[model samples]
Target: MTDTSKKEQLYELIRANPFVSQQDLAVELRLSRSAVAGHIASLIRERRLLGRAYVLPDKRPVLCIGAANLDRKLRTLETLQMGTSNPAYAEEVHGGVARNIAENLARLGLPAALLTAVGDDPAGSALQSRAESAGIDTRGSLRLNDTYSGTYTAVLDERGEMVLALADMALYDKMTPEFLASRAPQRSSAAMVVADLNLPQDTVATLLQDARRDAVALVIVAVSQPKMARLPQDLHGLRLLVLNRGELETRVGRKLAGDAELAAGCREVQAQGAQDIIITCGGEGVYHTSYTLAGEAGLTWLPAPKVDVVDVTGAGDAFAAGVCWSIYQGNNDLTLACRRGLKVAAMTLESPDTVSPLLAADILEEISEFHPLHLPQD
Candidate 1:
């Protein structure tokens, strides 16, 4: 056969049998083993085959695109002293809205990927390494020279409630439309896309536009009340929007009073184009509603299981992860999803870690609720 014919045959063999060895390809293509190796290398260079054993990059992961930061939290031991320093304990961890959610999904045994800009610094290295170790695909993440990784330092009272938070995350502003476009292949292939408001307004718009074009589920998680302005006025392609009551009020440009007012505010956000809205009330519970082709699904409230709060940092992200996992598992019931979200949030609140290392796939099954464990007899 000609060189072109040999290469074509080699690819066909690999496609038919992904586990076919180089030696088998040599015999199948009537070429030397070395020649077969060359052909395989050529095919990989052209992006036909993904990796060893002819693995394909075909997994439809939950694509999370936004900030990844180094987190520092300090909790005071004594009563309040605003102007002067108080005795406290400090802890550091890898954190960011998207990053924390991605870690949670990965820990829940879902295929997850992250696309975010990180500085080529030690902290950034640790961030990527930790995500990869947690089974998050970070290949599409960016590393820029001379940019220090973003940092979020939170000060908490003795009760573990956040008092103030300071952040230096200018690096995410560099995430441009061009950068997002460069990762279009990932976006197009995702089962769903989750983004945080830490990104710039234009970048968020680009992501929303791309999600609309690709007909993919896009979920937006608000990072903070101040960053709510970074969200575009049009959220037409959004599948779900998870935010706190304060963030929702900021989005609706009004102060929400009670459940009725919150539902109205959610409708206002729905008018802005979010398909579903989940407004977390921390310990109180969550207010949520879903929209379909017909019309608005009725709003519902689910109280969180009462638990002693250990740390409140990861509760929101964990809740978002729980809802995302439920949706990924084909459960569109918003009430049940919020139940799972509340469960995850409660678990995270009891742990001091940001992404709760204790999360596992089995947590999705509420042993106390409907699901029961049944083991096979030996």
Candidate 2:
């Protein structure tokens, strides 16, 4: 067989039998063991097909910059009667869109860093300690003195759904353009940069522009409510954008009444300059779109397996991190990439708080499961 044909056969063999050895390939392909090994190395670097037998992180690092806030949550199931304004219970946790993404990226075993501001108080200390223990770099995270760390209060019903939210992020408001600019050179090696709308518009724009100029991949997660519409308008070739189904429709100014509509809406957003757009339908799946050489193409919907519902607090951030990690690892199988995203989201929702219970290697393991078809055959 031709060399190309042999490589294709090798890739198929590895997918069918992930743990198969290079020696076995040598015997089967009539090639030297060293030749087979060299081919394997080339395939891996090309990210054609990957397996758990050999997966490595620390290969690419992710940088996250945005807001960090302490969250207080309350649990209550009092359905709002036609004329009632009362909640049953409330609870608290530490959460912010930026921090959530950071934690999720860390859990995915990718080198991750958080650049934000916090108070120089007990709450800030706790946040620092928690992030550090998770193997995240908190050195870039700032601490402001004589100021209270930002905090958010959220109410949940019996179904673990968000009822209302109130936040005080004055401290995070201090992460101005100057602060980010001063730290830019320190993170010139980042593989990707993740941001959200919690920070000021100028800050978001500045960071995106810098990342683009520096050639770092950029991903933005839309956080907060309808009042925060400035998010979609900031679109300018961001690597990816993850938003809820409703927000997707509203931002695109299209009525995505159903799955087909949602798919079309994602394409529309892609036309607006976002390199990739994903519309996450909670409990259903995610609708996505990406640009290709031919034109903007529709994405295959990746379904999330039904699981016991817990809290959906950090699911979106988890999903974003998953996709971001896969992109960094050079995996382009949208289907498997979505699965990796959903898996991390599920892990976070399985808990009451926004904290990620998973480790980095576990996330990498998920990324390794479904190799991209682009790889040569085993």
Candidate 3:
């Protein structure tokens, strides 16, 4: 074997058993003790293994990369007005697609790490504190000087439907390919990587390239219809791409009239190299397809459960987290994952918070028993 391949094998052995002795590693690889030591030294030089105990970098956490923002929601107490100020109730929270998904994953008992750009301002500090309080690891998150943290403001009608939303997410412009490359070790060791389209197009492409090279499970979440272009036309290494109907329409450049059209559009995107695709139809349900070992290709619809809507914000992020949790369990049955996604979406729909505070590791099990998600038989 090549020297590089041998070193990789030795490193993996050490990773599997950190306390394994060098003699064991030498015997396992049928190499001399000196050769094993050389490989270990090489691994240490590459930072794949740290310290003298063969301390490998952690590989359990799901890495989330993209935007982290301070979010504000204003709900109008009365009907619409055009040119004048309207009375409303306001609430502030820390929210961003990646940040929200990371929080959801953390609440679901996953080791979640967030790597997003933040400012040195109080809002940025508050955002990081809130994320840490939510059990997310923000040590790798970028903190910039003299920049305002990303912010999003949404105005909702009395029915909790969004009237208008404004986002000041220019800070995400700094999430460039170089920045992601600098965090190579963290990204490389993650169990999975989840990134949002809030990143620049070239940066997303760079991430996709890395996933393909390392055989990593990379999931990309769409942030907005306009941001759809940030995703490269070639999605070869993508494990999944979760997007809403509007976002899908934007990506494929056509209006998905109904189920048939949506399925066709998803298939088209999958043909472009995505292993799976989920297009969420708000209030309607989620349509998903997966490419498993058995090569399942048909898209199935999971109807959303009826819930008393309090606020619709962050429901999609919750759904992404639920699906991620199911995947992390090593189950390839994405159909079941869709059910979990819908359950979490339902939970979020019933709450006013960006991420439902009711979320817990066992919350899915608690809700799954009573509310079994199923499609209507034809």
Candidate 4:
């Protein structure tokens, strides 16, 4: 078959079975596996297809657009209740939801960029230095003089679980539509674009809509506080929306606190316009459902393998990064992505840091001891 004919057949095959194997494509197109791979690469570049599944086939970078702030971590010998004020040991660390994602991506060997606004203040300088050290591209992020940098103050007990958090994200609120519009082309090249609700509603809305318009793979991290949970209800075109069980319940104004609740919540969110949904239930693992182009219409659930819970601070973000990267690679194989996500989340829990203890080079080794990607049903 001619190249055009092969491309057409491949599209039909994918549309019919979005999760079809590339080996299958090679056979059906009557082409060498390399040739099939090259064609798929071209199609991805043209935005004719999104990510495929497998081990990181494309090294395309991930983009994170959100807030970066300095974390003033307050440590106490015992838990400091949220409302009870007391003197505590405090230390400043680089933090923010978007910055955390970027650091994790860099550690995963996926080049990532952060497009956000930070103040030109000393705290902002510290954050910039830390992000640069992590090898994140910050060219697209802007610095403002008038607005002080965003900051978070967290009070933690000896166990390291947070007692309360106070966030000042007013700087990020200044990021405008025109700013993102100018950066849209760069954003469009992303293998995945991760966003958090720290941004103003208009800014977040613009990014999601632009991702849809440009056909970029999008990963929306619903970083829920009682405040962030009021996310705009009209997120129509996101490829994936990642949230914790409580956040999902709050967003939909319904109870979805278990695996079954998560599954139902995924469907509910999908109906609201997101193409795929995942609700992470702390110890129970992740509940994922996406519109599989192949199987029956609607969503399908994949359970992430369970592990002992430690720190839960960054687990959801780590899971989002893993699933987004896997899905971008054309692997709609939810079980595989979930396993990767769980592995990353576990690594984060085992460490003191918000990212993972394992670096990019250690991912394969870390996951190798776990159940293989294609787990067999007994």
Candidate 5:
């Protein structure tokens, strides 16, 4: 067989049995052990295989803590009327900042666990079941008895832009610091811990503290404008902070404009203890800064790939997942990680669902033909 075919065969076998040894491959393919070793080495060098197995060794299961809810969207076919009922089509799907991020990570072939509260309602059951089916460990999740599951309802215009929305996330209030303390072992063992602002302020504080104590990378996703204030004032020990310009402005308590101003805002947050900051600008793209052992890094901006916008909802969650996945894969390059995030966000923009099933596959390959925008240096 040609080397290409031999490589393909080796790839299939390794993927099928991640722990398969070289002797096993030689026995199954009726080839010399040396031949199998050569093919495997080629695969690893070509980037088709990751490390000694299909997954990286340091890529441990991520612990995602926040909200899991049923998302309801009402899309109007025509102009919406004010103070009057308008005819529209409605759709419901699984959603929640943390829940979506966890599912995205699982779909990307990473092991993920979710720690959040859900009601004893059917919607709650469906959410948990779907997450588990996607390979997320939901055992850390809570099923509250007296409350109904949280929900996010959005009214969209014909163009798919959100016109208005309501979030009934009172259920997340039950996910307090004391409750998280009960799950300390699981929290401390994860390679990374992600939390959204939907979590109570005290709960977020507790998570930050635990992340510091355990030396786990803590990634925070700012849920929304109003909720951004819930984050701890001192962001020290935060590994990554993903948010939009508005959210960053809110966090810094100032209005920022221009690249210089935004870069300064990133530095302000970094001074307060955040190691890396990614601020997403709608349509324009994403800007990121990181503090490494070499000292402060310059701002790197990657423009968003042009795509048809189907729905803006959940795009941020997708972005968060991509960045976290890159970090889990042991990539310390902030610019590349932000590009991965932008790629996932673009995929979400093309789908009405919070997360497109297409995201379950290799995104880099899917967009290989497209070129990412490179901004001019200052």
Candidate 6:
């Protein structure tokens, strides 16, 4: 059959039943699974088909608030560096915790909006343009005139592990509570509000307060170890909290070396009122726990799938996107959500770019077909 004929058939099938899964579509259309997946991806990319399952019709777009900046990296050709210069390769791209998460969500076919501050320079303009191109609504973002856009530079060893990094993100200070207050209506209308610690402490506090007062689901991403403490002590209205092992240690005010210590830290944060907590332990895998009126859900850990390491720049952001996407899709199973998060993070780990272009919902479905994640029992 011709491509147009196949697309028309697929469109008719979807219009008839919006909840049809890709496997079902393949069977009904008498096409290969990958072919059906590709067609669905193209349809979504061309705006002929919407991702109905990935988002709810009644919910507003997810609001993401935090840093947006340019990222530069230098990878040494060989291991050995002190004060002297080393031969290396250099590259640059637009990156920030909130920006990466927002882009990943958009790529996964979710309605996302970004509220960040950037200078009026070329870098800021490029960042905004790229974000918009990637389907993120940047209307709520700020454009400062005098300051330069934020930038993060990292030096990596030959194995692609980060050796050292430096950041100039003072522009994030402009994303104050006053700035967020100006966009109060937008923040209140969101289905979920996601923020990273790149924002100032006062801004984080205001966001927490607004989310609580408005009764919106708040998801916070710990940008780094130092910034994790910026989160408010009273997480009364937090729906989900995403952080790494180091960040969790900082928040709990102690060293956590084993599963026992990690579980204690998770309980401590749950006591602070967060409904769910996801901690990404580099290679060991991810630990997740959910709390409800019934009681605490037991900790569920999923081992990370083995993959060739490329650059671990935005794996955490991709994981956050997966969890947020799953929640927005109305999935309450923490274990399932963690599996999805790991799947997405694995995809990101294989890509050198921060956000892989192949992060679409359909593409992920196809990848999972061949390389399914084995979830641990509760």
Q: Highest lDDT, which number? A: 3
Q: How much lDDT does each candidate structure score?
A: 0.84, 0.71, 0.85, 0.71, 0.83, 0.82
List, residue by residue over 1-378, the lDDT tens digit for candidate 3: 887788888877877766578899889888999999888888888888765556566646788999899889999999868799989999988899999999999998888989999999999999999999988878778899999999999999888888899999998989888888777655655778999999999999998898899787999999889899888999999999999989999989999886667777888898899999988888888878744345545567778889999998889899999999888878767777888888888899999888988888886654333233332221
Q: Report the lDDT tens digits of candidate 6 across residue range 183-209.
A: 765565478889999999899888778
Which tens-of-lDDT digit does each residue in 1-378 have in candidate 2? 777788787777765544467788889889999888877877778776432342223334587877777888776666644356666666656778777788877766677778878898898888888777876777777789998888888777777777677888877667878888667543554667888777777777776677567667788887755624656455574877878877786787767776557667766776676777777888777766643455546555567768777887777777888888778777665556777788877877787668667545665553555422221111
lDDT, model 3: 0.85
Tens-digit lDDT string for candidate 4 (1-378): 588888878777766554468899899878888987888887777777765432122435688988788878776766555566766767777778888888887887777888888898898888888888898878778899876899888877766667777888877766777888777545655767888887777877887777768677777787665745546677786877777777878877888544455566666777778887766766566655644434433333445555544455666677777776567667766656777777777778776667775658448334423332221111
Q: What stretches of model 3 exceed 4 Å from their correct place?
A: 1-59, 290-296, 365-378
Model 1 quality (TM-score): 0.82
Candidate 6 Cα errors over 4 Å, as ranges = 1-59, 290-298, 364-378
Error of 3 at 131 (Å): 1.2
**What is the overall TM-score of model 3 with all chains considered together?**
0.82
Better-scoring candidate (TM-score), 2 or 5: 5
Query: Candidate 5 on 85-188: residue-level lDDT in tens?
Result: 88898999999999999998888878898998999999999999999999887877889997799999999988788899899999899898889977755565
Determine the C-alpha RMSD for candidate 4 after optimal superposition of all C-alphas: 11.1
Angstrom error of the Cα, residue 22, model 6: value is: 41
lDDT, model 2: 0.71
Residue 324 of candidate 2: its Cα lDDT?
81
TM-score of 4: 0.74
Query: RMSD, each candidate, Å?
Result: 7.8, 12.7, 7.2, 11.1, 8.8, 11.2
Query: Judged by lDDT relative to the true structure, which candidate is superior, 2 or 5?
Result: 5
Greater lDDT among 2 and 3 belongs to 3
> In model 2, where do residues sit more than 4 Å from their true spots?
1-60, 77-90, 232-234, 290-296, 358-360, 363-378
- Kindly give the stretch of ten consecutive residues in candidate 1 with the minimal lDDT sum: 369-378
- The local lDDT score (0 to 100) that residue 216 gets in candidate 2 is 70
